[model samples]
Target: MQQKPLTGRLILADVARGLALLTMAIYHFSWDLSWFGVVDWDVSGSPGWRLFAQLIAGSFLFLVGFSLVLAHKSGIRWESFWRREIKVAVAALAVSVATYFIFQDQWVRFGILHSIVVSSLLALPFLRVHYVFALLCGAGVILLYHWLGDYVLPYRQFFWLGLNSLPEVSVDYVPLIPWFGPVLLGIGCGDILHRYDLLRLLRGSASPSVISRCFAWFGRHSLATYLLHQPILFGVVWAGVTAGVLSTNAGDVQVRSFQQSCVMACSQTVDAGVCEQACRCTSSEMMNRGVWEDLLTRPNDADVREIAQQVFQVCLRR
Candidate 1:
């Protein structure tokens, strides 16, 4: 057997990145199922599926930090750094542009890839710092997040600033600020591992046997996988929905279930009651007007804006 090349340093990270990517795919599959009327998106609260998704985001970004440290611990080069930075930055911008076209009503303004790009640049100064310093900075950032999260949500301008407010209209919104705190923590972790050479130890001796090589393969190309999987999943769900295999309207008290789910999911932006009431009201109104299909299959900006306002009014302003 040809001993796998790039197998040493890349080992743990490859596996970790793969697992995170898979988890993210699962989460998005759930979202697509909901979108296609196969199921309701778990928007109810932070209790069940939501917790898993957060864990996935944290893992990926931490890995991003970890990867950065691994990429350049041996040396620093402005040219190489800028080259990698440009690649990531371009991809991030592409994501924003494509999403803006697809979901103009709720396009990702600054999502996970954007975080990775910016956080990588931000992590530069601290790359050579002691783990102790990185730890302290992480703690400070977390504290600041808690202190100011609520205030940031109220100001529309602060949405881009990435604190307090929920991601607007975007399917996946991973902001900076407090979220970056976690990435910083990951950097601290990388520093400790690099300084102590613990990563080598983990690969050689400490890793769980159950993790296996398959999962690691997923980690290696996680970015490409992430980009491709969603469309495939959505296409499947969309076909099912079009074929009437999935029902947009679940009927009777099931509508309440939908409302509850929406309320719980969107409570980050506002209270659950607001979402439930608004969605229920809008759904009911649309049914009465015989325009429920329009709400569900909005093809233009006007329809998106109109239905979004209707949904917003019931959930937010109420």
Candidate 2:
């Protein structure tokens, strides 16, 4: 089944990808809005929202591969692609550097765009390979992150690799190991579509379904929409706060809940009790300082650890 170019099926993929991008924006807006005294969602110190965000990341990356194959269904064309790759790569690096400038304390050293740029560069080699081989590579990349964890696999250097048991000093680092693997899977899937012309069917080649059209439209311009959605969501959330649509009281229950999430995220260093106690005190002080929400939403590792330590002393006195 050979797929036609830019058919209904392609538009469907866009819509799906667009929805996923929108999901990510929703999460970020929820997070950012919480900071400006808007909606008080437990984004930072909560398991559910964290998982939601991870799912969003995984879907986005997977689709990146999916879309890559669909776009270049003919074959890997470096001459036409390299120029754009450099542009996106530079943009990604600029993001890291610029983010560092903005939030020196908790900068995003390697976020989603960085992963896409790196994966795009690395994926060229595997492009012509058999789809099965590509899938195997994807599996290996994801599994290696865990198999090689205990022996210290150069966190600083491979921080982009995402295979660390103890990741450091970053807000949302999507490393290469596991994350890149998805890109490969997407490519494999893309090739499968290309070989069988399944892309058209998936893109709405078979029948022009409304749902298919929606996702495809999204997939086409995911990059732009993803970049723009956050500011708009933030603005809306900000307005909600200003109009008092959302309350501004994240008190003791919130603190205890926050402590639990922080401990779970950081108890890997043989100091659970310390993290626990300090979290309690930090919560107390932060609440007193009227910055409890701030602590939950956008705190750095130093600040996170500092709070953990402060409460740990309470354990010593006890």
Candidate 3:
């Protein structure tokens, strides 16, 4: 039998989501700056940036589990559950299609939204299960992935599982593996909260400050914000660059860095002069092919890798 949807929103949860959105924006903005050469480091590839991104993604996924428990605490609301699932699935598809067109080489095939949809579906049975069971399952999943993640799958089709040794070159690539761990943990945590009647207490809590209310508003509309924020941010940055309000030397910087790194690595086996000449030749060829940025930012991209290999061969012969 279908159950009625749960009423009363959790302001604290909304506030948490709102804060996450704010941090996500900051990270994305930094990435945009890195893309525009306003930042000296590779925001997408740097260790600190990568960790920050993971934490943000983890927070969102954790909240997904928590919210699911809160929504279906009494009984499974099949109608509302399916409604939200369908909407999320559609949004995930949109993201995949849009990214495929925009970034053909480094598209997000299964990003955070896609993971959320799958995780939510997989989490259905766990909703009514004991919180400890959910917690153990979550930890098991995480441990399994940690131990076996290095083993490559036989088929490329299963890359979305995050078990393959293939290089990940997407704008966003949140897979099910350990990511589902956070969601399950969230379910366990939410169940604990429900057991202690903390959810009731939270629901009754008021947003005392203006900042809190603003954050709650953002949290409530997070899905809309997520979908719209990147495009708006990218467009604003693009417009500024086009209008000369922002200047960029990212290409030059990338080229110089690539050349220097290449020379340094090559000098280990060859003479310094030969390494310098070869690096220069490779750099020029990369620029001529309009792949200099791709070579640096997406070195593992198929076309970029192929072009680099060919260029290296020619440079070696020269």
Candidate 4:
């Protein structure tokens, strides 16, 4: 069988990657805003937001699988493959090290880049196998992880496998089980596209629009962009806060946090109206007593526990 030399680039793949990159940037920026207290809503904890994040991550993984198949379809491009892997491995290490300094408690131990490098290697053997087999394996792994959750693993090291419970503070964690599913699926998709000569079709009809070109450029240099975007955003936000351009009203932030937490806990037991009233009472008392600053800044469980006892008694009596 004659193999096609990698002469043409796939616009569709690049565009898809560009879209994922944009989505990730938007999500991360919003998360940064929430962290700075500019946004009262919890981007991380909300169900819809969480799903959006997962979809973005899954899309990127799928693209990784797709790119791998397209690159190695003719034969194993060992030199290029190793070069890309090394680049990704180094980037992953950089992320791990950088995040350790920024967020010492919840550093990215095995983030998206780490998962991709590992999964790429794992998926290599499956490239030569049938696409349907790859698809099935992907599905099975996803399902297996879902089932694995019912059982507990003893070791903390096994957390990267996605079977163990996640750590208390994980900013970005992409485990092997379900995350590998998208990569395998991408491989299958790549195989199907290759078999059908869809790459040629896509390349031939590729758009020459300015927007398309810009996105493609972003896709091409996604690694560099990914590495730099967060630092840039952090600097901008930090600078704004320092310059007093961004609002850092500690009282307002603390009040919202207190209300959100109080209402959430109270609503589980009482009515929404009751919860609202209780939260309002607690908020006012905390603010009046000058304990709000301490709770907001240097909150310990003991302090919270004592405050909760006082608030519960005071609010319940009213």
TM-scores, one per candidate: 0.74, 0.75, 0.79, 0.81
Off by over 4 Å in 1: 1-7, 41-47, 153-157, 163-167, 204-211, 243-318
Residue runs of model 2 more than 4 Å from their true location after superposition: 1-9, 163-166, 205-215, 242-246, 250-310, 313-318
Error of 1 at 30 (Å): 0.7
Write down the lDDT that model 1 would get.
Answer: 0.69
Tens digit of lDDT per residue, candidate 1, span 138-230? 778768877774555556676655654543545567767666777778888887877765666446335546564677766776767877788
Please list all clashing residue pairs in model 4, or write none if there are none: none
Q: Write the per-residue lDDT of candidate 2 for residues 92-145, one digit (tens) a residue.
A: 776678668855645778888888888887887676778999899988887886
- Judge candidate 3 at residue 282 and give its lDDT: 94
Per candidate, the number of residue pairs that clash is 8, 25, 0, 0
Q: In candidate 4, where is summed lDDT lowest over 10 consecutive residues?
A: 161-170
Winner on TM-score (3 vs 4) = 4
Better of 2 and 4 by TM-score: 4
Candidate 1 displacement at residue 148 in angstroms: 1.2
Report each candidate's C-alpha RMSD, comma-separated, in the order given. 6.6, 5.9, 7.7, 5.9
How far out, in Å, is residue 210 in model 2?
6.6
Q: What is the C-alpha lDDT of each candidate?
A: 0.69, 0.69, 0.81, 0.79
Report the C-alpha lDDT of model 4 over 190-309, residue by residue, as the tens digit. Answer: 888787666775563545788877788888888988888888887887788778898866655567666666665665445545566677788788778877777776667697669866
